[model samples]
Target: MTGPGLRREVRAGWSLFRRDMLKFRRERARIVSSLLQPIMFLGIFGLGLKNVLGGTGPFQELDYIQYIFPGVIGINVLGISMSTGVTIVADREFGFLREVLVAPISRLTIALGKVASGVATAMFQVAILLLLSPLLGLTPGFVQIVLLMSAVALLAIATSALGVLMASRIRSVESFQYVFQFMLFPLFFLSGAFFVLDRVPPWIAFIANLNPLTYAIDLFRHILYGDIELGELSRSLLLVNSPAEDILIIAVISVVLLSASVVSFVRME
Candidate 1:
């Protein structure tokens, strides 16, 4: 593309991004609910499970709340990022999407802009969670926070793309929500977010291995638990892959999903 064409595309992408952000800002209920849902999960599940799982087996030395903190954040990121796609379905229904579609810029720019907005919103919620981390007795330093944010950002890229891909095809908001939740819950449960993957049955493990969120959560634990020493069993169960491997896997998924979503948007009616 020539300089002027590139500039026009950049401006178009930014405009789409800005529009989503404006919507995000005006939705007061969305901001409140997004933060509340995860806190409820962390508090209710963390406290409840602590009694049952704490001071037992691999969790004997680990703080159960601390162990699942990153997992909770992963859930939040995954959920919010994917929900961003719902806006597209709504846009189509309300006729706003047609305006953007008529623009001369490539469809890829529009898809990416939407994804970028979702990533931004997810990260914003994550910042709030990280601030509340110390309340749960988890204190990550500056560098640790940066590393965690970087990983979460990458995870958001793939998830948001997946959402956009689905939204591109689904015509109704109701249907998109139904289909998204159907997939989202399974991804979270199979991600080892609440339990160790290694101890699960072979069938579950095999399915979890294919889930992108599984590697994402495992990557979170790998970073958050980097300095903490763990027993052989705990280490094996928690850290599914090395940092390098986790990043590579998530990166590959992000590329594939992003490419597919762009194609979906290009073909979208």
Candidate 2:
């Protein structure tokens, strides 16, 4: 791209990013509702399960919430990415998409703006929960906290790009909703976000390994509670055999998703 063209892309992306962020902040109900589910999982599901599990065996000496907090963060970020896709579909339905489509900037830039907004929303949700981490006995140093946020942002980019790719292919908000519903929970549960992947059967472990969210959650746990013994079953279930490998795999996946989203938009009617 030429210098002027590149500058235009950046400007366009920023404008779209700002617009989405403003809309996101203005919806107080949306913010509360987006957060309510994760908090419920932490309170009702985690606490209820804590009584039954009781830090035994592989669980060691921690409560269930402590075990699942990383997973909850993972779910929260992934949920934001999925919700961003719905906004893209809604834009298409409501006619704003036509204005975006005819803009002088590249389509990829427009897509990146949308993806950036989704990443911000995901980070915002995670930050709110991070403040409550001390109650769950989780704390991280400055560098560790930065890495955790960076890891979540990368995961958001990957998932939101994938969301946009699907959104570009579908015609209506209802059709997009149908496909996203089929995708969301399976991605969350199969990621082993709420439990130990190690404790599961071998076949289940294999299935979990296929999910990209698995690597992101593992990264979160390592950053927050690095010393915990997650065992071979859980560790082996990770697509990356080592920490460096995990980072490399996630970086590659994020790039792939961006390319896919761009191609998908180019082909859209």
Candidate 3:
């Protein structure tokens, strides 16, 4: 007979996942609020920058909206991933995490449930953006669809693990907010989400290569446009040869971070 422990773990995991899903559904306003930032960047920033490109072929005709669209997608995922981290800290603060920890369930099961909630949230945000893509002149084909989603899934999981790992050690949510603010914007700009990497100086380019978000954006760009150049003046900025290579590197990072999160939870007990 299967032990009661096994059943308890599964039940707890499902309950946690369902709770988050319901919470996400209830907060419908967040969907609109979250999208506004990306839209603003595309509209205000991109429109202003598009005029200066001198209409180059390598830029796909210097249509700035198309160049920055994938980065906008990154913004959506990063915003949700970070918010999920806040919820984890809130649970710890409010005694909900204590209640869950005391129960007869494996810590891995709980961690996976938490990670799943973050991943689901990101995908929901992505779905909204995918529907809006045509308005920006991005029409992903079937294969591109698969590639795009696969990249999003891998990146989402990695980011969730990172957030969870951070939350695990930090006792207070306020501290996390401080640290997160420092890390988040740097990652966004360093990822080349808003601009082509070609014009960036050598020092900045070197630092960007070390950021995981850089590879994630590379995968997004490759899959979305299929070897097309977002800027004519720039050489190929990809660190990896293909989207598959990018996915592989990110998968490794995800596994490492997920393992670290599991270990952190175990240590917390």
Residues 11-77, candidate 3, lDDT per residue (tens digit)?
Answer: 8888988999998888889878887878888888678777775365445443567777888888778
Taking all chains together, each candidate's TM-score versus the true structure is 0.97, 0.92, 0.89
Supply candidate 3's per-residue lDDT for 104. 72
lDDT value for model 2? 0.82
Q: What's the candidate order when arranged by decreasing lDDT?
A: 1, 2, 3
Better of 2 and 3 by TM-score: 2
lDDT tens string, model 2, 47-122? 8988787756545555678878888998889888867887888998898999999878788888888899889999
- RMSD vs true structure, all candidates: 1.1, 2.4, 2.7
> For model 2, where is the 10-residue window of minimal lDDT?
233-242
Q: After superposition, how far is residue 156 of candidate 1 from its true place, in Å?
A: 0.5
Misplaced by over 4 Å in model 1 are: none
1 or 2: which has the higher TM-score? 1
Q: Pull out the clashing pairs in model 3.
A: none
